[model samples]
Target: MGDNNLLSIPPTFLDEVPGLADALADEPLNRVAASFPAASLPWALLAQQARTHGNYVNAYAYARTGYHRGLDALRRHGWKGQGPIPWSHEPNRGFLLSLFELGKAAELIGEADEVDRVHTFLTDSDPSVIDAILADEAAHAPGTETIVIRGIN
Candidate 1:
């Protein structure tokens, strides 16, 4: 999000454009190559949308990219565990939530092992922070009925 040109397209911008979110879900891979840090959250949201629509292939592609980039962003931020993820730090929050999106995509794609692995990482991360994270999410969650993109403001 720092310098990525894609950030110019705010996440809410898609919400204003009807069918745009669904369109992204329909063809996530077409833009995968050009997506980076700024686009990671959008990809994650698209992955969630794809998952909801039963588009396993697109879900997997977007989820995989989101998970990888999100994980990298978290690690860079000195987060050593998973738990509920600090979903309040701008793009980091989107990346953290992407873990859940990734897990959902993995399940839809029949990647049971990947889903389990993600679950294990989350469960083993830090239970102490879970409640706070969840409360924060609920309090600041997005209004969209689809994938939950908490703390977008």
Candidate 2:
């Protein structure tokens, strides 16, 4: 999001570049890119949903695509995806995080219709927010907590 010409990412989230780069380096990810537009639409939708709006459908569609991609990776290269599940999960969380971080880049660019469309979709479809993402916002507490039940020293 930028001056209608240059798209830039926040410094804090620059780590995503490496994840994206990793996808490009891997053959499975390469295959997806080589397919071009035919294979890119659903993903593009995912980006719009997640990166452009806080809406759910776009986000879920985004996440579902990654889930499918992860499925693809498993099928082609035997990559379990647990290694880079975040890249696989970006689209899902993108919807909310993108919205939270970017704050209407479309509207900032005067894309009223785009803004309206995204908001409408969010309101109408009610995209499901995954728990991992919620946990993520909370500093990954869901998976990071220490459950001290019965400790008999």
Q: By TM-score, who's the top model here? A: 1
TM-score of 2: 0.27
Summarize candidate 2's per-residue lDDT along 61-150 as a digit string, tens digits: 444454354344333433332222132244333333333222244565455676765444333212333344345547833453476577
Segments of candidate 1 deviating more than 4 angstroms: 1-39, 79-84, 88-90, 125-153
- The list of candidate 2 runs beyond 4 A from truth reads 1-31, 40-105, 127-153
Cα lDDT over the full model 2: 0.38
**What lDDT does candidate 1 reach at residue 60?**
81
Give the number of the best model, judged by lDDT.
1
lDDT of 1 by residue, 1-153 (tens): 122233223221111223434545665544642433344566666676787688988888777787786666555555443333433334444454466677777787688988887665544432332354457657876656767656967
Cα lDDT computed for each candidate against the true fold: 0.56, 0.38
Candidates in order, TM-scores: namely 0.52, 0.27
